[model samples]
Target: MKLKKGINIIDQHDKFGFYCNGKFGGNFVAETARKPIEDLSKLFEKLRRSKKFLKKRDFYFKHYLGGETPFFKLNNLTKYLGGAQIWCKDVSAINGDAHKAYHATVNALICKESGKKFIAGDTGAGMFGKNLALAAKEMKLSAKIFMGTKDISRQAPNVKFMREAGAEVVPVDSGSKTLVDAVSECMRHYVSNCDTTHLAVGSAIGANIFLKICAWSTSQISRELKRQLIKEFGEIPKLKLINVIGGGSSALGFWNEFIDYDKKHVELIGVEAKYAAPLATNAKVAILHGAAQYCLTDKEGQIAETHSLSAGLDYPGSSPLHGLLKDTKRARYTLASDKEALNAFKLVSKLENLRPSLEPAHAWSECIRIAPKLKKSDVIVVNNCGKGYKDKKIYIENIGYYPE
Candidate 1:
């Protein structure tokens, strides 16, 4: 395939420099040391052409039925912070109130192409599962979403939405009753019925399918970000920071385009839950529970359990691409505690009048604190991953009742 106009070009051996406009420099590491350009291009082409991979979905317009998501301007904060300008990718405008819609829209297309009668997957926060189920139904397929017994309790509202979408919510009562167990069970189901079933993963950290799904889903961020810059300022926005990597898809979406771009000017920082960070503090490169990439592991090489208030970011491992990104210093990974995330969510809601998803809220607050120091004239875009409606219970349980 020919390289697109806006896409960046780089050596297969390089870790970063994969984007169209060189937004992120030397971001993700490339594992293929052999650097056979023809072979690698063929492989990527196979992924691009494979029906099982993905095609575009409808969320581009459906997310904003009325109009494009407004590009939030933070010149006030920019001036206060000295030079940094701030913008937000309003993924909350989507139907499910999260960026999961982007992945779901394409996963449904993949399910249909694979001729799968049933869609099977797992969820912790419920955003991805619900989004996948809705996408499947929209594509005329059946969905079976496996949820942990714990997630069933924590993400009840999302459970209801999945059921309403004609998905069978199977509750796993196994160990932890969290995302890991549910994923193990889902893998079992997939292996048992690989003949007819396809797993629709929400995030890109674990499975190869997830990496592809996320790559396709998150590409929209680049499109929108470019449009926002072109519309607002006469020149392209000088990007200082891009945060959207919780669960890695949204981060991948916007950051992928910048992989080969100018590294000195722009920076890509992925914000994960403070307790569950593969990029921040983890040392080892190992396979995670259901992921095909390198992860943070224990002494026995078992995937280390992650701790986080946001269910979405609680993964023991990150996407292999992310590992590559981290190794190359094309991106910086950071963590935010539950308290910090909750406070960010509250601030965005009060100031922007938008209730962002918990995962992005964590990053948003962190950005708000550091934006003043990063660069005054530079633009920072944070992917507000999802809305906070599904997190109401967790909020009530941890923080307090919503301030009415």
Candidate 2:
């Protein structure tokens, strides 16, 4: 538990820490901007008694980056979209069905290693909720899931899985009865249950542990993308832009390591739901619920809202790191509506025979919109977040059926 020179413990008791670069004022808590000693080992030891979560430091790496995920060239998509070239980092097939599994599984491990009794989380019954439940069962830990009534009503498939996985699903009927309300209710629960529960943030927000795990989990795509592009094209082409966002974990998973890259060569885009646009609507930083660091919130204290068909993106704010990226003008932020997201979802299913998670496809939808404006020689990588298995029933129920 001795203090390390370059590593800063972001969460003292959770063994959540990050490496600090000398620049940008070194490492410190985003709220107090205070540095802490490196005592993660002691914290890890204390948490190791749980026997439900992971005690192994390399578990995440072994599980996430250990396998070969598809990184395929989008010959058909590029021609279809009329872009230079399109490629997908196929996170759709990650364990438990979504890229969120990468983060959730690691988080459950962290919760177990931290001696946390139970894992609590909120969801719209999307990949995040399902992944957490799956991970909890895999780790032999109990899980409490807060989801919106509407999400439960709509996302029945995921609800079944959550129940099957032994998760206690609490439905939020308050407020909008949607993703936002579910997250709010979950935060309220976490605040009251903080002593015994470790709120496993679905994405790279909420707690520092998410950022660490996501950075490592999603880095596989970026690393593979670079290698694949090089092998295919004989060189690492200028990464004109990379677009995706969530609690900012998905984007951060790829973008965090490349923070210092040449800004002119690569562009980063963080897409938000049009109804809950934190980066675009609330540029001024504020602390979001359940966190000490600043985030995007409205004057009324709601997370800046966005509108999207994807329940996964119903949050009002981006992670503070995303806020920092936005403030520094290091990333471009955009908004897409539910209509656009649904269109993209259907388009992907029809064209690629791939039904992506609504969230990642939301970002890809923007890429499709912008493709015509780009040069034909350019290349783009889209984070294909999750499979649409959980969403198919809802799609069928709402739209009747897909055309053959």
Q: What is the lDDT of residue 259 in candidate 2?
A: 56
Candidate closest to the true structure, highest TM-score: 1
Could you estimate the TM-score for every candidate? Answer: 0.83, 0.80
lDDT tens digits, residue span 1-404, model 1: 12323543222223332322232222232232123222333444565566545223443344422224556775544555464677777767767667667777666666665556788877878888898778777777889898888888888899999999998999999866777777778767766666577666667654343455566666666667767777888766567555645557777777666665566655788887876776787556665533334455778876667777777777676666666677667788887888988887766665666677677877787777787676556678777767888887777777676543
Worst 10 residues of 1 by lDDT: 20-29
> Whose lDDT is greatest here?
1
TM-score, cand. 2 vs. native: 0.80
Per-residue lDDT for 339 in model 1?
Answer: 90
What ranges in model 1 sit over 4 Å off?
1-68, 75-83, 289-294
Instruction: Report the C-alpha displacement of residue 404, candidate 2, in angstroms.
Output: 8.3
